[model samples]
Target chain A: MSWAWFHKLGSPKWFFSWSKPWALPLFCFGCLSLLIGLVWGLVFAPADYQQGNSFRIIYIHVPVAMLAQSCYLALGAAGFVFLVWQMKMAPVFIKAMAPIGAVMSLVALVSGAIWGKPTWGTWWVWDARLTSVLVLFFLYMGIIALQNSLEDQVLANKAAAVISVVGLINLPVIKYSVVLLETLHQGPTFTLTKKPEMPAEMWLPLLFAVIGLYCFVAGVVLWRMQSEILMSEHRSSWVKQEVTKHGF
Target chain B: MAFNSLTEFLMMGTHGVYVWSAYGFSTLTLVWLVWNTLATRRKTRDTLRKRFLRNQAR
Candidate 1:
């Protein structure tokens, strides 16, 4: 495809119009898939012989934890786009994503703690995996705070971008911290090089949830981006015409 | 397959509290996220509408 097509993505109005058609259906599909996955994994899927029903928590914990890291990567990418191309939508995307990501991380941490209570016989641990994830959560909060605190949007994006890039140094730290610290936390259940040991019956639903959650996040982000575009482009003719056409 | 019956599943072999709490918290977070996203969109639209009217009046 032409690079010009890529450049057009920089236009907020164009993206807003483009995303409008796909948002609702994607959101609906996401919600449906999430519900199905949760029910299937929690109620129908066979539980672990060793961990018993406690392993069901994996349905939520794993997905949220994966999202927690991936969202940060997305933020970092958005920051890079903002800095390099000065995409008007980039800061808005970062703004919208930060709180969502922070909350996801919080959920991951809390769920992991809950899972830990019975499995590990403790709610809190100094284990490397747990500690590093905690740090990641804080990093997400820091980026959000930095963005909110700045008066200038451009400056705020820059500050948050720098923080996000620096924070990326921790994703690997979080992943391998268990190995480094040699703690109670188990090694990876799933890996790029190795197929997950989980049975197809269990993993299928988890995979569905992962895909659904990604779509859900995308739909939310696009919706937020549209609003941001409207806010920032209020003076532009397309936005004015859009508002008029929509009877807003 | 983990439990012999529905009762056992709910009981979770004495770890019910921890298991249920984790699921409960997960559900709450999912609900809250959906609510937050919808509310934000509505609020943004309302604010934009108000601004548009204000500009027109000016």
Candidate 2:
């Protein structure tokens, strides 16, 4: 396979232009599917015999929790890439994605806590799964804080990359926590190897919710990356032309 | 439909507060992220335009 495409992606100008046309469609489709999934899950799907309507929180909770972990994984990979190849775009991806990841983690934590209230009879627990996710949230915040505190761009990138790379240890711990240690949290609901232990009525809208959330986050990340690119390449003639053309 | 009336739908069989609050908070967070991204993009363009115009006049 040609590595040319990878190299092309390293260029800020190429990325900015390539991504511009994609953001709107992704956002629109994401919003549509997300809305459908939420409404279906909340209003149309039958209530769980045991948990009743509160189980509907799973629609938002699972998707954000899944994305929270995925975002951290992406950060680790990007950190590794930046360290190995000195890829300029890698740090930008990390910078743009950190806040989003942090927010996802926060949502996951809050929603999980909310779900736990009626289900587990508690708002918070220091169990393996829950605590590890809390750690993930802290890791994200630490990276964001590191980037903001450093005045030197190169130093900031290097520091953030190192933290992101090191923090990858948390992902597996978060993944297997429920099984590795007895916890209030349940085991995986969606697994590739086995069919979900849920009825079609329960899992179908969840499918839409997951896909929609991923697309929505992707679109927002692209926009943030574009903004980062423009700021970093402000002096470039292409950026000048691009900005002027937009007439914003 | 899960419930027969709007009131039941809203009440969510007594789990209404927890379910709605979770949804409400998650929705607000996601919306804010999108809004903030667009606002930042616009601000960046505005700053760049002013700089370009300033340099052109010089």
Candidate 3:
């Protein structure tokens, strides 16, 4: 209930100390859940009569795809924070998260391509959903490039933030593309208003995989953010003390 | 169990290649993401440590 904790999050030192204890546990839990989900989906869940075992790819595909969109939303929110409030940690979040977002998009695209081969008889499609996601990937790449290319840190952060905030226009496009357009991609598998169309046995492992991937991303973002903090704050005495204490 | 044996599970009733490749590639990438993050952290700290030592010597 206290906004004090929220304000403290803007400080790199506080965030570093707060997140240090959490990173490893989250990463471990993520890996464990992912292991369980993948194995259960592959070995225990019933195979789809339509797509057969290739449907197994859905376990990974859906989670990464979902993450791809949500991560972009995070980036946009961080950008907004950086531009409006000028929070020091906001740009760090952007820098740390951009590569992860890019990689997640890559994984989703690749996994979906692999899944498409068996189910759709094609490896690639120019459908609205697919094309928009491809643009999303490019948008992530552009943000990363913008951040790295500028020698001036302030300018780089500003430019990246601008792009990130503007790029938010695409999320809704990606979300609605399947429904709004005549596409080969299926409609939403999971929605809050109604239960998923699939049986519990099938969607349950998917649920695990989704939650696991989210935890995994959170842990990684924390790790990367800590690293970014140390690098950016290296000249500060507390950072020096941390570096000495950790002996890294 | 969805399949009768490990072999059947691996084969995935003839959809093995597609299923396995997707999992394999994505898993490798995820592993790389973790590896890269840690490596960057270590590398950053190492640079900072060396800078400290250098400053002390100076």
Best by DockQ: 3
In model 2 chain A, the worst 10-residue window by lDDT is: A239-248
List residue ranges in candidate 3 displaced over 4 A.
Answer: none
Better of 1 and 3 by lDDT: 3
Instruction: Give the CA lDDT, 0 to 100, for residue B51 in model 2.
Output: 93
Best by TM-score: 2
**Could you give candidate 2's per-residue lDDT for residues A160-205 as a string of tens digits?**
9999999999999999998789898888889989999999989999
Write model 1 residue lDDT over A96-141, tens digit each, in one string: 8888788788989999999888788898898778888899889889
Better of 1 and 3 by DockQ: 3
> Candidate 2, what DockQ?
0.84
Output the number of the lDDT-best candidate. Answer: 2
How many steric overlaps does candidate 1 have?
0
If the candidates were sorted by their TM-score against the true structure, best first, what order would they fall in? 2, 3, 1
TM-score pick, better of 2 and 3 = 2
What DockQ score does model 3 reach against the true complex?
0.87
Model 2: which residue pairs collide?
Answer: none
Alpha-carbon TM-score of each model against the true structure = 0.93, 0.98, 0.98
Candidate 3 residue pairs in backbone clash? none
